[model samples]
Target: MEFGLVLQTDPPAAGVVALMRRAERLGFSHGWTFDSVVLWQEPFVIHSQILAATERLVVGPMVTNPGTRAWEVTASTFATLNEMFGNRTICGIGRGDSAQRVAGRRPHGLASLGRAIDAIRDLAEGREAVVDGTPLRLGWVRDGRLPVWMAAYGPKALALAGRSADGFILQLADVDVTEWMVRAVRKAAADAGRDPARITVCVAAPGYVTADDSPAALAHAREQCRWFGGMVGNHVADLVARYGTDPALVPPELTAYVEGRRGYDYTHHGRADNPEVAFVPDGIVDRFCLIGPPAAHVAKLRRLRAAGVDQFALYAMHDARESVVEEYGAHVIPAFARP
Candidate 1:
C-alpha cells in the first residue's frame, strides 16, 4: 500500500515545506494538509511550494470544502499546480467542517459537495462542466490530470464517494470499520454500474510507533492522539443529528463513542493537547489510531490492505511526528514496498 502524511499547515510555511520534503525523501508518496483557512495557513499556496521543492510528492488539501471558494477558482488552482508540477496533484474534498464553522457558517450539504466535485474534477481535467448555472470549462487546461477523492463517514456520503469520487478517504484507521466501509463504497459502486476496483481506498489516522504495547507507553500514545477521535466526532455528531441514534441509520460503532461528547472546540481542533477532547475515551483513541510498535502497525496495515485499502495516510498531529515518520520509513513502509 502507498503511504501519505497529513499535516496541519501550521506556523512557518517553510517548516511545513520542510516536513513534506522530508516525508518524500523518507518514501511518502503524498502530502496532505488541513484546509481550515482561519485556523491554519492556506494550503493551496503552500501546495505550490511543496510541489516545486519535491521530485514526486503529490500534494493537496486533506479536505477543502466547496463553500469556502468558488468552484472555478479551486479547479484553476489545481490545474495551475498540475501544469507547473507534472500532474502530481489530487483534490480531497468534503462537506465543510472547521473551514466553514469557524467562519460562522454551517457546512454545505452533500448535494453542493457533489456538484463542486463534478465541476472541479471536470474543469481541471480539461472537460466542460456547469458551475453556478453557467456552462464552464478551463480553457487553458490542455491535459490537466486531477483526481477528486471524497472524505466521508455516513452512509449517504459513502454512497456519494462510491458513485462519484475517484477515491474514498476514510479518516480513521480501525480495521473492522475500514472493512465495513470499504465494502459499503464498493457495493455502492457496483450498484451504480461503476468498476468497484477502480476506486481507491485511503485510510488516514494518527500513527505513533511504540517499542511495546506497555500500558504506560500505550497511555502516552493515546493521550497524544485522542484529539483525533474528537476531530472525527464533529462529523459523527452531524450523522447522529441526521440519521438519529438507530444503528440501522448509523452504525453503532461510529455513534456509540460520541455519547459522552458534549461538544467540540474548533480552537483545539486536530491538536495533541485538545483539553476539550476529554469526552473521548481511551478505547476510541487506541482503536482509532495506530499506536503500537512497527510490527504491530505492519500487522494492522496488512489487514487493512487485505480489506482493499490502497493507501494509508498518517496524520502527523502529535508529539512524535519525526519519530513516527522515521520509523515508518525504516520499518513499516519497506515491508509493503515491491520486492
Candidate 2:
C-alpha cells in the first residue's frame, strides 16, 4: 500500500516545501491536501507549492469540487499543472459538498460529472475540442496523462467512477464499508470492460498515537471535529451509530451538529462542556479515530490493507503531536509507504 500524508490548514501554509521534503526523506510516496475553500487553505495553490518543490513524490489536492470551477476550467488547471510537473499529477473530484456549496453552486447532475470527466479526458488527450463551439487543444503528447479519480461514497458515484475515472478515493468510512465500495467498483469496472484490479483505491482516514491521554492531544482531536462533525452525521453515521453512545445524551447541543445544522464555530465549542465525554467514551476515539499508540495505528492500516486498499492519504491523529508524526515517520510510514 502507498502511504501518504495530508496535512491540514496552517501547517500546510508555512514550510510546506520543507514539510514535503521531510515527508520524502521519511519515505512517504505521495501527499494530498483538502480543496475545500473555507475551512482550509485553497488546495490548488497548496498543491502547486508542494509539487514545485518535490521531484519524486506524487502530489495533488485530495479533491476539488466541480462546483468550485466549471469542467473545462478545472481541466485546464490540471493540464497546466501536469505539464509543469511531468506526469506526477493527480486530479480528484467529488460531488459538491461544503467545499463546493459554500463557494457558490453544487455539481448538480451525474451527467455533468460524466461530461466533466469526459471533457477533461478529451482535453488531456488533445482531441478536437469544441468546448461550447470554441475549438481548443493543448498539443497532443497529450495535454498530460494525469490520473483522474473521483471521490466516491455511495453506489451511484462509485459506479460512475468505475465507468470513467482512472481510480477513486474512499473518504471517512470503515473497512467494512470500504470493502463494499471496492466490490462495487470492481463490479462496475467489469461491466465497463475494464479490469477491476487496475482502479486505484486511495483511502482518507484519521490515525493517531497518544501514548497516554494528554490534555493537548485530546483537545486537538476535538478541534478536528470542525470538519469531521458533518462527516460523522452524513457519511459515517452507520459506523458512528455502532460506536456512539445513546445518541440521546449526545450533549443536546451536538444534536444540531449531528444534523448538519450547526456552524463550524458553534460545533467546536458546543460539545466542549462535555469534552471528556468523547475522549473517554467507549467508541468515540476508536470508531472515529485510530488512537492509542503506534501499534494501534499500524494495526488499523493493516486491517485496511487486508480490505484491499491500495493507497492511504492519511490525515494523521490530530495534527497535535509533532513528535508523534516524527515517530510515525520513522515507524509507520516505512511499513506502509516506503518511497
lDDT at 190, model 2: 94
Off by over 4 Å in 1: none
**Ten-residue stretch with the least lDDT total in model 2:** 263-272
- Against the true structure, what is each candidate's TM-score? 0.98, 0.78
Could you tell me how far off, in angstroms, the CA of residue 39 lies in candidate 1 after the best superposition? 0.2
Error at 56, model 2, angstroms: 0.9
Off by over 4 Å in 2: 9-12, 128-135, 140-143, 212-229, 236-285, 317-321, 337-339
Residue clash pairs of candidate 1: none
RMSD per candidate (Å) reads: 0.9, 6.0
Model 2, 5: alpha-carbon shift in Å? 1.4
TM-score of 2: 0.78
